[model samples]
Target: MRVPVVVKVGLFALAVMGIYTYYANSIPQIQSALPEEISLEAETVTPEQLVRVGEELFKGKGTCEVCHRIGQVGARAPDLAGIGGRAGTRRPGVSPTAYLVESLLQPGAYVVEGFPNIMPRVDRPPIGLNRSELWAVVAFLESLGGEVRARLDDIPKTAGVPAGEAPVAELKLPGDPEAGKAIFMGKGGCVACHKAGPLGASPVGPDLSEIAKIQTPEYIMAKILNPAAMGTVAGYPAGVMPPTLGQTLTAKEYVDLVSFLLTLKGGA
Candidate 1:
C-alpha cells in the first residue's frame, strides 16, 4: 500500500529505525523473531527499568513498530510520538493510563479516526504479554509525553487468550511470490483497483505497496477470502472487493497471491 507523506515530528518521533530507512542501498534481512518470554516478575522493578524493557518489547516482541512509528503519521495505526499526552484526550473521562491500558488490552474499544479497527489484542495468544509486561509497555508508552504513574496493578491478571481465538500467525504456506504477482496483476484483478507500487494506480482501492509492513500474513490471506469480515480501510467503501475470491481462485492461485502480498513491505 502507498504510505502517505510522513510529517516529520520531534527528535523522539524522528528516530527512524535503521532497517526501515526507505530507499536504502542494502536489502533488508527478513526473519522471524519469536516472542522472547520476558519475566519481569519482581515488584521491585523500577519505573525507569520498566520503561526500558517496554521499549525493547515494543520494538522486538510486541512488533508494534511494524504498524506504528514514532514521528511518522501512521497508516495502519496512530502516530505514537506524543501519545503520552494525546492519549488522555482520546476519550472523554478516560485517564491516559486507562486509555493506554484499554487500547492495548482491548484495541477495538476505541478506534482512532482514519485507521481501521484491526488491532489484535496484545494480551492474547501469540502476542501474549504477561501482567507485568503489560504494566511495562503501558509505562513505556506513558513516558512518551506524560508522567509515568502506571503501577503493576493497572493491568489485569486475568488478561489472557480468549476461549476460541487461534494462533493465526503460525499458519505457513510457501507459495511462490512470482506466481502470486502474476495473479495480482492479471488473473486476480487486484491491479484493477489497488495500487501495488508503480504497478497500478487506481483510486478505487487503497494502495497496498506496504501491506505486509502494516498487516499480518494471516490477515492478508483471510481478506482475500472474506473482505467484509476483515474490515475496510477508512475513506474506502465496503463490500467492493469480491467476496467470492476463495471460490474463484484455485488453491495454488490463492497461495501465490498471499505470497506476493507478503513481500510488499515497500520496494526498498
Candidate 2:
C-alpha cells in the first residue's frame, strides 16, 4: 500500500532534523565565555610574565586587535608595530610612558594626524581594565619597539570617563529618583565615593553632579551593570568601582538608582 503524502513529508522532515542534529553533535563544541577579571596588585609579576598577560589581554579581553594591527596599516586605527618607540616623539615634551597612558586613557586628547578620535578609554567598563591590566597592556605595547617602562602609577586616577556624547535616543526608566537617591546614600553606599548633587560628598569617585547631562541613559545603565566595560571616569582610579552592582541590587533598585543619576544635570 502507498503511504500518505503527509507521512512521507513527516519522514523527510524527521530525517532532515536527525541529520542536522547528528552533524551538530559531530562538530567540535566551542563555548564562548566572558573573560574573567585579572588583578596583579598584590601578586609579584616579572616583566616577562606581565608582557605575556598583556599580549593575551590585547588579543582577547582588551580587543586591541580589532582595530589596531601590528606592522600593517589598519582601517580603523594606527598600526602599533613600533608604537612604543614612536609614542614619546609623537607629542612634544611627553615621555613615552605618559603618552601611551594618555592614549589609552584619554584618546581624544591628542588625535593622531591621520586617525579619527575613535579609541575608547581602556580603563573603563566594557574594556574596564584595572590598574594591573593597564600596566601590563602598556608594557606590552612599549615592548613593540620601545622600553617596557610603563608603571601602575602612569595611568591617571581618572582615566576612564563615559564618553561625553549623549545617546541618540533617551530611555525612560520606571523608577523613582527619590528612592534611587536614598539607595545611593544609604544602602548602595555610592555616596561614599561619588558626589551627586546633594546626596553625596565623597571625592574618591568622579563627581556625578551632571552625569545625566553628559552621558546617555544606556551608558549609565550599562555602566551600572558592567562598570569595567563602561570605562572609568578620567581623574579617578580604575577597579575601585565594584563590578558587583548588577548582582547585588534588585531590578527595581538598580532602575531607581539610574533614575536618580539621570536627574543630575550640572547647571542645566
Candidate 3:
C-alpha cells in the first residue's frame, strides 16, 4: 500500500514548522518593555543620580545617539563630544546650561552647520522627554565637556507633553489590512522584532499587539517614515528600527502596513 500524498505533505509542513519554531525559541530574546516615567519633583535626587538617569535616557528614551554621536562625527547630526564646553560659546550671550536646554527644546532654532535641521524637539511626542528627563539629559551633556548647571526650571514648562494625548494630523489610509498583515510578516520584517497578535512571537522590540489602542495613526505613519525623528520607544535600544521603511516600501505598501498596524488593538 502506497502512502497518501496529502499525508506526506502534511508531515513535511509540520516538520518545517517545528524546525522554525525551535530555532526561534532557541535564539536569545530581548523584550522591549516600556520605561516608567520618573518624577524628580517629589523625590530628592542627587546630581550623581540625576546624571546616571540622564545617561540612560540619552541612550534609551531620549534617543539622542540615533543622530548625535559622542566622540565621533555622525552622518545625521553633529558630534556632541564637546557640546558642554562649547555650548556657551556657540551663542555668546547664552550660558552653557541655557544653550543645552534650548538645543533640546528647540533643536531647529540653531541647526549645526553641515547638518540638516532635522532634529526634532526632544520635548515633543514620539521621543517625548519629560521635564525631569530633559533636566537629566542636559546634565549628561554638560558632563561631556562642561559643568552640570541645568536645573528643573531650565526646561520649559510646556515641554515634554505626554505623547498619547498630543493631537495628531488626521490620516485617511486606503489600503487593505489583510494584505498589510502579509507584508508585515514577509517583506516588512516587523515580525522579527515585534509581537503582533498571532503573527509573531519575537521579543526583540516592543509588543505591538495593542499599538493602535495607545498610539495615533499619524504617529504610526510618521514613525514608519522617520524612526529617529519619532524617537525610540522606552526600554528599546535606539537606531534599531530601520529608517528606510518609507523609501523601501511602495506608497501603497506603506499605507497598507499602517492600516494593518492600526488594527492591532490588543487581544486580537
Q: Candidate 3's error at 62, in angstroms?
A: 1.3
Cα lDDT listed for each candidate? 0.71, 0.69, 0.71
lDDT of 3 at 140: 91
- Candidate 3 C-alpha lDDT tens digits along 45-90: 8888888999998877676765567888522467888888989888
Candidate 1 TM-score, true structure as reference = 0.62
Highest lDDT, which number? 1
Candidate 1 residue-wise lDDT, 161-251, digit = tens: 3223333333334678899999999989999999887789897887888676556554676678778888886567888998876666766
- Point out where model 2 deviates above 4 Å: 1-34, 159-268
Q: Assess every candidate by TM-score.
A: 0.62, 0.48, 0.55
User: 57-152 in candidate 2: lDDT tens per residue?
Assistant: 888767676567888862346889998899989889999988888888888888877554446666643355667778889999999999888776
| Residue clash pairs of candidate 3 | none
Index of the highest-TM-score prediction:
1
